[model samples]
Target: MRFFRRLMLCVAPALLGVAASEPLSESFDVSVPQLPQIVATDGGKAVRYELHLTNFATVPLAVRGILVTDADTGKILRSFSRRPLLTHLIPLSGTRDDPSSARVTIQPGARAVLYVELSGPLPRRIGHTVDYVAACETCPLRLEIPAVAVNQAAAVTLAPPLAAGPWAAVQSPDWPRGHRRVVYTLDGKARIPGRYAIDWVGLDDAGRTTRGDPDRAVDAIGYDAPVLAGADARVAAVRDGMVESASIARNPDHVLGDGSGNYVALDLGQGRYAFYEHLRPGSIQVKVGQRVRRGQAIGALGFSGDTTGPHLHLHVANGLDPLKAEGIPFVIDSYTEIGRYDDIGALGSKPWQSAGPTRKSHEWPASNVVVRFR
Candidate 1:
């Protein structure tokens, strides 16, 4: 699959056939990869798609609302405003009231992602054509998407791609809707719909991250810690020598240019790939085209690339390129639930409550829940 930097806008010839000008005409563009038709676990017909929104103007654009409807019947299937039940089916970053209260802003030349879900047992007939309207302050845009044919093949089941180890989940999908950091991405492609992804960091008994010092990249815990291969795999890609961004306000060009700095991409057979990002400069031990086994050390964790601090950013996707692939769910072999923090901001000082049990089978650790490996 190819990655797109920006979407192209094509106006229907019927709309005066003239190229749309600034303000509403050519200010933004939207595209959907494919409309996946599937039967939800609830036995309802489901359609899941992600909208890639790009702003072409020089100033920021405030997105007021989004409305989706059946093009033939004009029946509104979902709206960010009226239908709370159906609209809630999609995992949007902000609250329901956000559209009118405080709309989402799209920075100049930046992109935004909106995952939408339409499901119900009643609508036995799926609409072949879907229409959507995007409400913004300066101009409103509408799109008519021709639904692609459905793929009847069964969904692929996923397995854990990591070794058993004590780790803390950060910006994880398991977190509360608004608090989930993985939902936001710089390129608008990292937030894959229906798939679980997470950022991990190591921790000690004192709640302090194992390695690095705050504000100082080198002093941070987990710095230079060994990064183990989650499963037997072939090195699909490797990148190194990218400079680290020490502060939260990173250089946009570097951050967006080389997202997974000094990293490794492992193809674990099938179509799944394990991505380990932000490794220490010159610390990568595996090269592209190399073969590795489960639990093998591939590299040392570092603060390299578009990171504010040192930590291991790992995710399993359907393809080798993380940002362009679909994120998939997986479980670690085994781990003990240690404790969880009440407030992540008070990381080093917060007292953790003892966890209840341990799991030996495949399962995802709860957000902010601490876990230890045997």
Candidate 2:
């Protein structure tokens, strides 16, 4: 009987159909922030996840396929073959090739980033699990994402920071943070942060962004625009004295200290911080520790930081430091979706079409959609 028990123990795993050998690096790492990082936006019409994939081998790993499915029901949520999956890796930090490039190769010790967004109407809570199959030559991986890890609750709702006027949600969270990278901070410390940051630009008639020539700082319409407090809050921190660059080229060295150049951070209670960045030097009106009210003028928008031009770089995060904190989502009480902008064409020449005059409330504008505040 003792011999029979030992044999059963040995055959138990096989009876349960366990694999005899693991993949080359089946233990390869997949990093995600604490669970329930899932966020809902566009009035809960969308759900997003920022996933990081790391390859810890010496040879290059090519991500050739992907599959996202409902774990319980075996329903396929999303799937990508080699061709489409390659596009997903195009925006990763290291890859420089066009989307037409067939395969995205991850260099040894590098990460392959992916931004996953599932359109709603979705459940308030996922209540199940998601199965992920990332097919690769050297790092093929399969894992499950818990439903509890994704929170579909409403993001923060707040009053519009700027007074009534035309402004462009030039770079907004309506989509992934950058054209591809989902998290707000360039540094990986932030998890699902800055998911909804907005780089706002005010526009004028004649489809011109500035008053004069495009290259001149003074010609930009966003220059000197009044940046207001989005809510009643206390000043948390301030950074000033960084000179605005003469042109739109970003100086990589300044990203750490002056990237947000001459900015104001407001504590909006409940541990939420409102960041108003890229302000003109000496234009800040409130000092740290000062109490401020909604609609109070804080500073003029400027080109002082790591920016393409003069625009309000606004976002909310969990902590005081923008670089370290995870980005949180918020909604403007109301704004009118006025038009769309052509980013590749001459600056500000994008045509404005009537999304109609009707004003929409409790809305979050997507990236590149022009809107008016009233």
Candidate 3:
């Protein structure tokens, strides 16, 4: 009888079909909204992009890790965890920020964005494996994003936006509320126009950002600095005749007109538009349909828009919509790396920490670094 029972157990799967199949439904819908773009950084190359995740399950799903890999070889490229992972995931809808709660969790039917920056040799395509656990479920789940194509389009190479330097190419390194993290959803589309933007904050001979105090707009070093054209192109758009504050405002809420104030947009050919923002009132020298030469003085930087002080906000985008266009990367033709800083206060404290004055070409200056553009 025991032998007969054993035989029945062995043949049960074939005779009565007792074998189980894994569930085919996914817990989350994963997509890459844009192709990851490649930039030639000082250290090899970096892929910059984002992933949009939407919860598919009825309950919440707490994201644990996101693993990026080479699509062809399946080789691991970059992985994120802990605090790094927490800060990168931004919930787009229906979630309150709680310090104690796991910030990576996406509620049912809610969506979140994961900003990813991976560095290495350029991959033909990238893949992703996202680990998460659903509420009211025992087992963890993984969502796979297979074969996202890398954007092969080369970064636009351009001349320096200013004729002089010892200028600080100020792109914030922080992920929290920096230009790189702002994903503006407007007109039914989402894009980050300042992903590669830099605030060209000029400095004086004594290595000071301001001559007197930061409160006075004219005292700021970046004020009245000539905003130069990065390319020989047509003046696509210009916003002029905006009033400026005599004193600097400290982190005030941004309101009024696209937050750019008086500005000039250059059509740099190939559908790329270069923007120079926050010009001094009545300083914009060019108008729409005018031709501009490379290094031409288009305007002067000032505190005309939402700003902590006077500075030129320069960026290249795919469209004319400053808020809705996807920001693209560009490299200055030549510049000397002076050093870096954590904040504006760190500059001129002790000679910029010395980057050895090495001339770098066809490379974008890193965040908060001092550079003398040639």
Residue 187 shift from truth in candidate 1, angstroms? 12
What TM value does model 2 have?
0.79
Give the alpha carbon lDDT tens digit for every residue of 152-181 in model 1: 434333233233445666643323342222
Return the candidate ranking by lDDT, descending.
Answer: 3, 2, 1
In order of appearance, the predictions have TM-scores of 0.59, 0.79, 0.89
lDDT of 3 by residue, 151-266 (tens): 88889888888866788877763556778888888889778888889988878756678878767889887788888888889999999887887767654555745488789999
* Candidate 2 residue lDDT tens string, 1-374: 00000111122343556754343332224555533333434444655555556656566555555565554555656665555566454334555434564556666677766555566444443322212223344333443434424555466666776765577776632333362255444564545445667888878744568777777666688788888888889999988777876766443347455667889999988888999998988899999999999888999888887777788888887889866676766777778776666452544775555465556677667657677776
Q: What TM-score would you give candidate 1 relative to the actual structure? A: 0.59
Model 3 TM-score, 2 decimals? 0.89
Poorly placed runs, candidate 2 (over 4 Å) = 1-27, 34-44, 57-61, 70-74, 90-103, 124-142, 145-148, 172-193, 246-255, 342-347
Which of the two candidates, 2 or 3, achieves a greater lDDT against the reference? 3
**RMSD, candidate 2, Å:** 6.6
Which residue runs does candidate 1 get wrong by more than 4 Å? Answer: 1-166, 173-195, 210-213, 243-255
Identify the leading candidate in terms of lDDT: 3
Per-candidate Cα lDDT values, in order, are 0.57, 0.63, 0.77
**What is the full ranking by TM-score, best candidate first?**
3, 2, 1
**What residue pairs clash in candidate 1, if any at all?**
211-220, 211-221, 211-222, 212-219, 212-220, 212-221, 213-219, 213-220
